[model samples]
Target: MTDKATAAGELTDIGNKRYFGEGLLRWYRKERRDLPWRRSRNPYHIWVSEIMLQQTRVDTVIPYFNRFVGRFPTLRHLAEAPEDDVLKHWEGLGYYSRARNLQAAAREVVEHYGGEVPRGKAEVSGLKGVGPYTTGAILSIAYDQPEPAVDGNVMRVLSRYFCLEDDIARPATRVAMESLAQSLIPEGQAADFNQALMELGAMVCTPKSPSCPVCPVGEHCEGRLQGRERELPVKTKAKKARPVFRLAALIEGTGAYAGKVLVRQRPETGLLAQMWELPHIEAPDEEIWNRLDEGAGLLEAALAEDGVRVKASNEVVGEAQHIFTHLVWKIKVLGAAALEERYVADRTGYRWIGPEEFENYAWPNVFRKLLTEYFLLVRRG
Candidate 1:
């Protein structure tokens, strides 16, 4: 390989690094998107915005960020609120675990750090769910610490700029990218430089069809010069999501609980843990699932196993689909009625909530859609 080709893999050239950093930051000051999170320097606000922005787009996160910060306002407010309330605000955003972890970390901050976000790297990283990217982002952006946040955006920009052909999905690539990114942060310009790199990737050097003609640092980008901008940041594809067939019961209330519906709390661990949902069971095959009567029977039997009994109707109320990172749930909602009112006495993991009480429980998006449809049906009748 020629010397220039070999040099593309390393950031040993100091002049190039200075030029790239300075050019990107200059463009950022003139063109940075007017985001709500960028308006504040409070570590708490920045921390919340960074967590929400993970796996979510800028436009989608804007309203959620506004409402969340408006509601919580401070670490103490989030720590004091019920987990259900916090999850409700975070509903429809997906990745519900982030919301739960944020609250857990908030409570820790309040109790341990006197309600102030810790500035030290060790203390910040120790907070639950605050990983390397978040640690660097919070430290550098909020506290002006010269920490490098090497998330996918930063990695992509760096990988393409230096023509580094490392698989970003690998841990080793991230460690090396963090070192290279840290080196590019000009003295006392870590905040602007890091944000500028991320913004450049997000706005200019996008994953597909990057607009290189207008990129501020296009003059020195090795990937662009070598015609490999689209392929430099190679990533291993993720495994396919496993499908799960579920029979959900929209069990109607009877007797004293009339005008309400039966909902159950998920186990305290695993996916959607502690969230409320209509009773559901894992169906074995489509043969049984296609048979509405059998599906209702299976749902009733499953609820009975949990010490609750209901007479499910053969009519199917609705169906919904939800996708998680590793699991895809194809849910069929079946209508049902309370068989006997006596089962209400043992309401350990279950409860009959009136329509108005729905807001009190945090229903996962799938259940939320199903329940919304069911309520609309009731109102139409």
Candidate 2:
């Protein structure tokens, strides 16, 4: 609740709180979708599912979650697996940093906690990539501890139900919401209650337009009663992603390296770290990027500056776009042929791989799609 609400004596009535909890639980038990992660009480499975579910949809994560657990069935397996193999399993799932942090945390657990997730809140929160929300989720859902797993969905639901007009994007507001959420958890029903709140938010109390009439606790929803359900839970908008233009070379190999294409691994740190992709260079402006002949020359010059020589042709091969939280890359690909055999002695990061070796390296989604299409066209030819 905001200070204004508190000062106005607009606290959640005791009756409304009781009804909200009981109504949510009853509705969840009866109408909840049967999810794979809910089938068992395994802490590892629950932790992985929570991590994967962050900023990702439930339906998209189902198959990935199943395959991930099947590949690394236990904490030790995940801790011991090679980074590349772990990355391979998580290839299509964006936000590669999540997978990296998860593996790092798994290794820490294996060594310090003896391959078991710690029950203490501090211990779980200390793991890499496990923030307050994830900590609460693992503690409550996995251990059945009375913790509040408050996320955007939970906040939206609570703000509407309680008619809170606070800006949810603020750190202080989240802390208050977390405190309120923890207080509402029913005794001995932390797991189900927390999940129920999340389910209600996801299904009924949505962001755009809430289905208030069908909501179990709609009878007492302050936002709905006040006719401000959509206006509550105020949030600030994020900055737009900045656009960048890049030129990529689809360099075909010749001589002994025939049937292969040139590729390079990204630096060990920073964006798309350690991922492989077609050789490319950022264009100074969009105009040059759109001009294939000029962009091809700039691409060759840029790669030569880095000791990677290729003869880029004016013909366009492909074009694609990849969006990140802060940046967007508008890429134009040009046909090319490798011009130097010196790369053979340079094992730095460059490689000439044929379609048979596609499975050997993980690629960013944009490049993966481009390469997949290129291979399919070649096969047809």
Candidate 3:
């Protein structure tokens, strides 16, 4: 906790924003990191950086940010672009929902906000996916508004400086932390003030093995002075490991001369929704194929035909792992023989594209890599 004398003194100077503001500004001028997002005061760039940084590391976001900014240099560019193209750019950098929400928010900005990002908290927060932290981030960092932009880094810094006992797991912690941040925020250039605290947390007062000796506000850090640097920023609980689900299917009856495979479009919801993949069913054990049609079975039943024969039974083409927030899929592609012109129609269309045309379609690179590796090793084995 802040010493009584120091708290009382700082509180007395609260009304005089000039003093606190200049102090923070001076420190920030000497200590801020050279991040790409910090190079410019563009609201759209700040918004993109904040979104990409969610559940993502800063080092990992550098290249993604560069590529993203290169692709969509402005809010108008992103608003007019297609969602899939944006999502494709965001692939490999997981947490795909961010990309979708970003596109939605961009369109709203162009349509509603007159093509400019909102500078106020209420307006920024009302966007589709920008939350309190993001709103503050954009407002302060981009517009130099007096918002604290409190994120995990800010929370840790505040928690340790105040030696806060509140568990950060609770939503109320956010409310309290933001309040405290606002209370201490140096006025005028809210940008530098917010960046100072964030830089302090990220670069010096890290989660573990903090460099308290070199911290800018070392004298003011209550936790550091009390020999509790590592214990100040209390965390909540740990997450349980995600459970894995497996799915597979046998492709059969299709002639090798025509060179086509039986694939299906997944439902328009849930994991990898709308993505095309080979027909498969999720089964735990004990011959999952026994319950499905092979040649004159499920495929024929679904296709309403009997002119089919099983070529490959259950040839595992190897496994590809896909992960979501709460789910994991160990996907196995079972190769099989298939007859010509035997495929389901309507909402799901099965096409036989030429081998060279594989690049023409957009498939999750994970599955594409899996298929490539599987085919390559099959010939060797």
Candidate 4:
């Protein structure tokens, strides 16, 4: 078979391709969800929504998208905004790196592309956080270019329709999927077609149980016909997240600093970079970490290593967990009070802030909820 024939494969017959595209387009136009992002073809708007939608559900991203655009109405606004302000807005969204990279790419656009989202594939793809999928999404959705936005949803839909058994987790499979997706895009309908594929995957051809009976293109679905619809889009399992134990200090204020807690900003790099949280230290093991008394002593000694002294109480303030792709932080928050009065003001990345000033800093969701709850109790007393 020729290279074109091989790439096209047996499923690329003209009649089948035409039927699939037309059916998807018709179904999408009539049944598409009224998402906020679908209201415009503006590249910036589409770009932000696409980024926000990554690994996030549509219902969850709706308010965040609306608020984000409302706050940073233009690319110039996002480019010029402070990193803290951007992170503050993206506080609960998780994957904070997305917000940071979006701002960085926005700055690059303002400096190079005259503050407008560029039309060229290379230019769009060159921006920070703009991967192959995002590049295709921006180009096809905004510029109406016939690029394939083949994310998981698109991959799943294609795999089921064509009965592809290749592991969707593999990079080579994604390239093949992208090629197939691009080929299927009808002329001048790139945006709608791409969205339609995603819609079908998300709403009908779901991972657990596909709604094959009501699927728009169910008539010709190879996976369903062969009774392999549940397994066609083969994917390897990801590594389990490793668990970590740590103790955090919820130090109450004293003397000059009253009705406040001690908080610190994380280092400029690494996991949860540059975000604020209560002072904490990694425990040697879960046994020591679970023992409130030993944990308090360990927490005090750990803080002393950095020339800051805190006398920890035996009381446990709260417990929370923050899960990342690779690890899970099992944090036990303990009540404590500052022993070093001199460092209570503003020493290094540490500071004492009251409940009213919580908005001034961006905190991880786990810490935010812990501190917010603590303050509410303080207020009630």
Candidate 5:
């Protein structure tokens, strides 16, 4: 019923699958990292961990995840929280959109899924931002389904084992890996097997300088046999370098009180949305200083950059440098006198809040710290 080539291919697939399970599992059971996420099977906890772990390191995610779970223990709690409150809890986590998305997805779950994290892969994947990998992880580890959640660790392990040189981001690689994973998804023990493979790759079959000699399946690793472990998981293109930006903001120094700073809320979209930040300009120019001299600095240019419209009516106080994960913003702080106008017309998306209000305004930690440092310097001066 089968030709020799077909039979050989099947046998090879079996060998690879069996070798992966035994090797990775044996190693994982022994050397799995003592991560907080591993301590629970509750779908909500698993869901939170999966979301936080995206594009973030395990070490970096620990405190944030702990704080997030402590603050919002369940889906219902997160679903009902205000966006700013959620952003407050998510401070310093960078990638604020993930927090926003998590809350959005939570609301969807409460409304449509009976306040429970969906167990079906299709249902889970269909949520706001859950992708195939997250869907697989939720269904496999949280729901104990035989779904495979492939991440960077899994990609590296598989690519090295199969000696695949294709870029893991490519769909062809995903398809091939999914096919292999389907064949290997253990008949009845999906959770342990999936976790075991992930743990092993994370702790042993790591991307760089993996522990090969102690690897339980080192003998079966194609890359190991070929001495090409570090060379697998080849990326198609290098990440392009982002440009640096100078930040300039005005603080109301000549106002009625004369020492307080000026800050406004960013729009409720794009980067740093709904967060309180100082009135700033990109190319701090002659027009900025001219407006500052008249106690009515201009904010029109910056607002235009963000596709909003507002007038400039403030003065300069100071400046600061802020480094983002990908972009650097050098902020110029200017203490300014306020204009006697309080309407949404100032900006379709802005609010003028005083010092006390700044604490609860959800400014990025970088800006918050900058304001603090600037104040301290002025006090000392």
Candidate 6:
């Protein structure tokens, strides 16, 4: 373990630590946003909010959070709910794995900890999807354990205050920041101090054009003094998302399946797992994409591989785009009608869902948008 003297070497002179810590906490008490999660110190609520808040903005998460908690209400409630229903609530939130892990962890908590969120570091860290940052946030915020929660916000604030130029995207830099953050927490003030750091970063020490003048510890901020606030928390650029073209089959149902559309469940594992979507086939390249008839043939062939036969029409119904972290999908919707009224015996994964039944199954935002547009088009006709 590195000594505090070495870990916080250059940052040692940034005013008295007590002044910065206390002043920030005082400011937080007066200015902290009254978010739904802050209303209680329940570990479960904090855990849920923290998970949802990852890679998502505060304002955007508010309604989702309210709805999620309203539906689940408690850890047990979440654990008991169907995974599909849970995904339904989290449909548009993205980073869907977070929801899955949250439910898995909730079940773990119920079975292993008597339905209570564990307070100890080791126990909490063992929970699925609970990383160091989340572990610290729950322990400090809910249990008042004086642990450090070093997320991007805390790292940015600390980097600017201490003028540390380490790349926050690196693992070593995060470890160092965690240490520095842990040292700054005053005894028994972990909740307020941690929250204050995050609040300052969000509202004042933002990524761009930080409000340096209004910062409580502005005078002591080394990055501000050096005029390098914007450059301190350096992060490497992420790789560009690769584009993928796909042909989505808007299969129209007939006979017993009339007034319904054909949808299939994604495999139980991997990207967008367990969500329902329109049957789609990846177009080989720009050549395949340029020819709708050829693309329709490929879509039909792909569906046959899955044991469902259909004849795709050349007409394009609509188009949509969805971007994941590493991939971008440019989709072209094509009309199709089932060649046979009944699918093969093992067609359980595929279903004919009516417009009104759309609410029962969780569709990724891209598919949901496509289906909505298709339904509106039908209604107009």
Best-matching candidate per TM-score: 4
Q: In lDDT terms, which candidate is top?
A: 4
Look at candidate 2 and tell me the lDDT of residue 155. 99
Candidate 2: where is the Cα deviation over 4 Å?
1-12, 341-346
* TM-score to native of every candidate shown: 0.92, 0.94, 0.79, 0.95, 0.82, 0.94
Poorest stretch of ten by lDDT in candidate 1: 337-346
- Over 137-185, each residue of candidate 6 has an lDDT whose tens digit, in order, gives 9999998998999999999999898889888899999999999999899
Model 2 lDDT tens row, 53-83: 9879999999999999999999999999998
Q: Higher-TM-score candidate among 2 and 4?
A: 4
In model 4, the number of clashes is 0
lDDT of 4 by residue, 1-381 (tens): 898887677556777999999999999999999998899899999999999998789999999999999999999999999999999988888999999999999999999999989999999999999999999999999999999999999999999999999999999999999999999999999999999999999999999999999999999999999999998789999999999998999988878887888899999888889999999989888888878898899889988887779999878879999998899999988888888666656588888889889989999999999999998998999
- Candidate 2 contains a number of clashing pairs equal to 0
lDDT of 5 by residue, 185-281 (tens): 7777777777877776777888777999888888888998998898887878645445443434544434343445556777779888888776665
Q: Rate the local accuracy (lDDT) of all candidates.
A: 0.88, 0.90, 0.69, 0.92, 0.73, 0.90
TM-score of 6: 0.94
Which residue pairs show collisions in model 2? Answer: none
- Candidate 5: minimum summed lDDT over ten consecutive residues — where? 336-345
Candidate ordering by TM-score (highest first) = 4, 2, 6, 1, 5, 3
lDDT (C-alpha) at residue 263 in model 4: 90
lDDT tens per residue, model 1, 1-381: 888877874545878988998899899999999999898789998999999999999999999999999999999999999887898899879888899999999999999999999999999999999999999999999988999998998999999999999999999999999999998899998888888988998999999889999999999999999999988699999999988888888778767877788888998888898898988888898778888888888888877877787888878778888899988998888878777656653578788887788777888889888888777777787
- In each prediction, how many residue pairs overlap at the backbone (N, C-alpha, C within less than 3 A)? 0, 0, 10, 0, 24, 0
Q: Provide the RMSD of all predictions against the true structure, rounded to 1 decimal.
A: 2.8, 3.0, 4.9, 2.5, 4.7, 3.1
What lDDT does model 2 reach? 0.90
Q: What is the lDDT of candidate 4?
A: 0.92
lDDT-better candidate, 3 vs 4: 4
